[model samples]
Target: MLLLIAFEAAKSGLWPAISSALFGQRWGDNVVKGSVSALKNGPLCVLLNFPNLALPLMFVGIAAMRRLLGGPLAWAVGLMTAMYFLFAVRYSVSDQFMFFVPFYAMAAILAGLGFVRLSEAGKRRWLGVAAIILLAATPVTYSLLPSITQRFNIAVPGRTDLAYRDSPRYWLVPWKNNEDSAGMFARTAMEQVPPGSIVILDSTTFYAVDMIRRLEFSDKDVRLVILGKDSKMDAIPVGTPNVYLDSAGEGYHEKWMDEFATYDRPAGKALFLVVWKGR
Candidate 1:
């Protein structure tokens, strides 16, 4: 259903804005990378992270369930397990963990049954199995311990092997996931314009700033025009007041690019709102 909506939006020229709002620019901006690098870094990152423990445990759980559970439950678990593996192996991003949530839950059910099965075995065998489980969990425990301690206001020595520090996956963090002065750019952009000014922003900054205006600042009078193939400055009257919110050197449409005095923001910044009186 969502895919259909996206297809229709693409047909109507709204997918760019819709995609920006849904996934943020990391995915939308790098559509090429998302497509081409689908099999790249995700699996390795999953292996390094504690979450990967569930993968092996899930298999064991499924095997255990095959005997203990009904055919339907086993089938469901098997289906989810297959889906999880495919998602994990296909794309290598941190938020991809979201797709693993249901798989992990089903896997946990299997692991629980497996544990019960182990307990029903002889005492020594149960102990051995329990030790192995703990060993499997050791890396995750070590990884989470510092954050857990810090959250509880306990002082603990910093662990150096944290996934964010140790893994290449850290670089794939989403663009919108990081800290920013909340709504600063949006607020500044709105403040730069007169109360009734129409804001013209390149596609990159358009959705983000417009979202901020609607949610945080609540500036109802400021109209937003997102610049893309389907939308351009030509729609606006030539002499109307407008502001261009985008980073410099984005190669914005030549019509607006040639007219506005460039407001070059610091290199690597995400937004530069250039106030314009007319062409």
Candidate 2:
């Protein structure tokens, strides 16, 4: 359904703006990495990737239901359904229910359980038939869904940055996901930043890139700063040795980059890596 909506938004030429709103420059503006890492490491990632693997999971869910959820198929169904929804709260908080992928995965898991329980060979055969039919109909249905009428809307504009900067969900986090998230921001700065200058990220991808990729940041000149939950200064990160993350403000105020580089931030560094050789 996310793909469906994204495709529809893109087809209608609202995608870039929607992307900006969803996770691009707007909401993601606070984040540094692409979340490529966050999506890989933790529970938030588990749910992020859940939709992609939903198909085969259906079969697995049904088999597990029959085999594990008590003796009978009905009992298994009840258990799996109840348990998944209960567990899904974790996923929901991470994803903030901004998209539909998680819900779809849970639905597929239940369907798979039902397909597995049909003992009649004919019933099993019909299940296979239904699966094929639904698979085939998906594109048709996607094609028929309405075009995007409105672009993405940021529910909480302040929380738009990546999870690292604000940790708005920190109260619910199982542990320190912010460390990696903060590193991700640093890594993103190292990427687009020219050597020996500061870099600023306006998207979440800044804090979400791969770690191996971090070494690519070998040039020491790059220094990046993710915005705090609140902006105490009217500033920006642009030009050589200076980067900016200012969607909420404009008409930049200049500050000596070196002044901020030394400040300590528990979330992470307050400025860029501060050592690199720009091209």
Candidate 3:
């Protein structure tokens, strides 16, 4: 069910690609490999039981360590650590990576089962669960994680006056990426100009929206700005660019600004707020 929640709202490439973009890093497109593996897993999950992922992982991780010898176990640990670090480097775990939570759960079970033994019925149950899981995964993953945008493309109207999504109430982007506020790097400078001043984050619409709701800011005359400037997101709304300030940079470029616009601690970006320069 938790898997399904992630599965339902899934977006592909957004996480992996965006993370790379934010960090000025890059990685293998991996679409071909991604597609192939997803396809292969479809059959595997279907043939086996749904693979009650979390439950088994908790059960097996400890049990396996107990049984495996020091030599091979140590090697396995080393290999896993290396891969994790590699992914951390050029690529990273992003929201899209959440899509893999269930799948990883499945993989974890496979690993644990390898070292520790289960009863015949336990094995059968596992397989049955794996099959059911594939059944769930096949359609859910197919709908959520597609190699191409066309796979999960949702049609939208160019403009819809009566649309609920267009309403100001709904306009407050609630997602992390929704463009609502100013970014951390530029907010102080923009705010320094005066009240009703607008500086844009150019991404993270929800962050911008949150600013409107929490601060005395308004989204009424929201304009778009793109997140392309040596800044974060290439494009964003003029009235409503996703801008915020972070303490990491502390007025320095590329610390919090040091890296790229991302969630930071001690201080974070403030959402885009506007003070009309023209009016």
Candidate 4:
């Protein structure tokens, strides 16, 4: 039943999402363009974009080692890792990579199983092998340093570079990416906008906005209209109060901006809050 609902939503939602010029055309264009790029660059290129090249091999190694040395539990972890790759390879969008969390968990399970087996194999003599693997893998994490990591694109030669070459963040320290800023923006929106106003936003900004509401921001009275997915300005009921909150970016809605009144101008290139005229 749930699958049926999900399928129906996809079928019905494509056009509405596309007409909004956010998800529909953008997604299709990306898939089409990425498909061509992937083919030209070959398998490694595609894998690099999705799992950063080393990860898929690590996943495969874990699965294979588990199958040879461990029992059913370890084997299952391997199988799950393989399964995730099967799906991920087909729809490997970087932004949508969060869907592969289960795959990562399974890979971790396999790694843990390997460590246990290594400990047992040589009666504690082979324990150092596991420690060595850990040491080798530690640097890969640093390879994700946004500065150097961002430049490590194997698909494009000369673009590849060491992960720590120019990175400022110290190795292995958790870096600030999304959590703090998203929360701040959500709070700002709730505090500035009146209750019960319609807050229209693009798909990306909508997630943070909705997340803040769901978590403790607590301004539940407002309605969120995800632009490019929901109806445009004409759909709002007469006399209804409405606000449009969009993050500043390539897809700035000029028509909406020209029509609406700027309610609150927040600092940074992250987001903007606007309201419909006379509301």
lDDT of 2 by residue, 1-279 (tens): 345546757666676645443444433532323344333333343342332334454555555664645667547455545443433333212353344344455557655565565533346665677667766665454333222111232122124334345333332233453436556555544444456443344444434432323566544544444445222344433223344342222212123444443322223333323321332
Question: Model 2 residue 91 lDDT?
Answer: 28
Model 1 error, position 257 (Å): 7.0
Across 191-266, the per-residue lDDT of candidate 4 in tens digits comes to 6666777676765457877888778656468777777655355666434554545543335443555544554455
TM-score of every candidate: 0.49, 0.35, 0.28, 0.47
Q: Rate the local accuracy (lDDT) of all candidates.
A: 0.53, 0.42, 0.37, 0.50
Per-candidate RMSD, Å: 10.7, 17.1, 17.3, 10.1
By lDDT, is 2 or 3 better? Answer: 2
Candidate 3 lDDT score at position 164 = 19
Clashing pairs in 1: 42-92
TM-score of 4: 0.47
lDDT of 4 at 25: 42
Over the stretch 1-279, how does candidate 3's per-residue lDDT look in tens digits? 323334433644446444442332333454222344344443333223233343454345445544554657645554443333233232322223323344454445444554244533267576567746855665454333223333455322112221112322222122335432243323333333234333333243335433543453343333323333443433322233233332222322223232333432222223322222332
User: In candidate 4, residue 234 scores what lDDT?
Assistant: 64
Off by over 4 Å in 3: 1-51, 54-58, 66-116, 119-122, 125-278
> Which portions of model 1 miss their true places by more than 4 Å?
1-36, 44-53, 87-97, 121-185, 188-221, 226-230, 233-243, 246-263, 267-270, 273-279
Residue-level lDDT for 140 in candidate 4: 68
